[model samples]
Target: MAQKGLCWKEDEMGELVHTGTSSPDISVIRSLAMKHLPGSYDTMDVAFFAEGSFNKLYCVSSPHLPQDYLIRVALPVDPFFNRESEVATLAYIRKYTSIPVPKVLAFCSSSESELGFEWILMEKIGGVPLSDIWDEMPVEAKESLPTEICGYLKSHQDLQFIKIGSLYFSLVRERVGTRDFGETSAYPSLPIVVLSHLHINS
Candidate 1:
């Protein structure tokens, strides 16, 4: 087997600085809520929820909306992470399948955003993250969670794809687009796998 690999520069990001843990301007987030989710928040109640190495999550509430929201802001400038593709995938699963995913109330990609980074405003998912409460949870609940998640994953097993790439939807084309390639930490070739010229496309 012949091994082929794409050349990538370490400093591929020109001048775009990655501000890990540094949040975007609160005023920009406020303006976005007012503009897109006018029905949700006349005055945004934004609060710092948590921060990860790559993204910051906020808790946003509105008197108008039925539930609170979670606005995730990508802090790191990672070439592999595609927020648009994630939004598209969530929207597709929510629209076409029974899979449970947060509804994307609004989203802005890095280039199209006023905040200078990709962000997603979605319906807040209930319950604490498994990492936080897993240790304290009962064995019955732990067993059930994976069983339920596996069921969800099984639902989409019948859905097939020929080539692997980040998933995105084009409003102009009005369909799911899977052509753009980007780097990722886990998968080198967008969403596909190539090892010693042995292809394992997902």
Candidate 2:
């Protein structure tokens, strides 16, 4: 498979940096959401929710849904590797630690998908950003923040991987790796390892 080239934009420092500017089709998005989302597509509402350096997020909600879901569409910047690794890492965290992370309901790592981009459909985690209320937080609350943050960090440190590369689902690793790979420290699912070849063509 041919590797997709990375997108670049000028940073504040005037240096070129990889940047993601994916804008997924809303109509197709609605169709995709309707597949897993509850309620009639005609009654469902899909709205832009958020954006990060590498992804554009959309919120999907319908009267029939138990809760709203987030659709994250990633830009072409690492194409397959970024999304696949992220799903694997999130799965690793949820399986191994007490850290709260979004639950992935469905995902597609291929840019060639029906939506024309890689996407993840996940349960929306409810909470306000810490930055929004940091100043309003009481001194006592601020004091304990570090401890709470460190607790999550500590949990990550407890996990040990034999290989230094990113984690991946066994299926993804098999599809991308040059050969069958060995398992790592009993991570709930099959283990994966090492660099660029970890992407899934599917």
Candidate 3:
């Protein structure tokens, strides 16, 4: 699901200047899969999956793996924290909870060689998005989902973070989490809620 965006540039004054979501062609996606995936997956069908404001997602499927894979590529000008922050976010979630999220198989926070983009390849979570099937569910199922959602949210209370930003893992990939913005003075560890996969009307 690649979208063409007009590349914008800024002047030396650093004033508001340009914006566009970077896109990767299919060949590049295939090459990336071949480079990073297991050798057994000699071939893969890389199909465009979806896109968000700052990211384009592609679905990678191979007979070797039990499930399909997803590649999430971040735009060069992503307004949110860097790609590492996203990788760390998913890593932190995986380390801390049993809530089902895509398992981060491989990621490059910094653009490597010709890739020129930060990307993550992971096991895709299977199911129709809650948004797609939400209103069609029976009232009982709809009521029951919130209780499950609240239960999941409650699980985050144990996760304590002092800053109001994304969390990142250290070199050893354990302990000592840091925010995307450089660290600040010690503050009270507050609870955070990541409203992903929820269908609440905002």
Candidate with the greatest TM-score versus the true structure = 2
**Cα TM-score per model:** 0.64, 0.79, 0.69
TM-score of 3: 0.69
Q: Put down candidate 3 lDDT per residue, 9-46, tens digits, no spaces.
A: 56689665545655677778878877777766667899
| lDDT to native, each model | 0.62, 0.77, 0.65
lDDT (10s digit) by residue, model 2, range 106-168: 899998888888899999988898999999999999999899989999998998866556666
lDDT of 1 by residue, 1-202 (tens): 1111112233555543333434477888777767766464557788888887667888887677678888888743432236755776786567556787898888876534687667888888787667999899999999898888887888677445445554554441222223333333343433332111121346
Question: Between 2 and 3, whose TM-score is larger?
Answer: 2
Task: Predict model 2's lDDT versus the native.
Answer: 0.77
Point to the candidate with the largest lDDT: 2
Candidate 2 displacement at residue 13 in angstroms: 11
Ranking of all candidate structures by their lDDT, best first: 2, 3, 1
Which residue window of length 10 is worst by lDDT in model 1? Answer: 1-10
Sum up the clashes in candidate 2.
Answer: 0
Of the pair 1 and 2, which is ahead by TM-score?
2
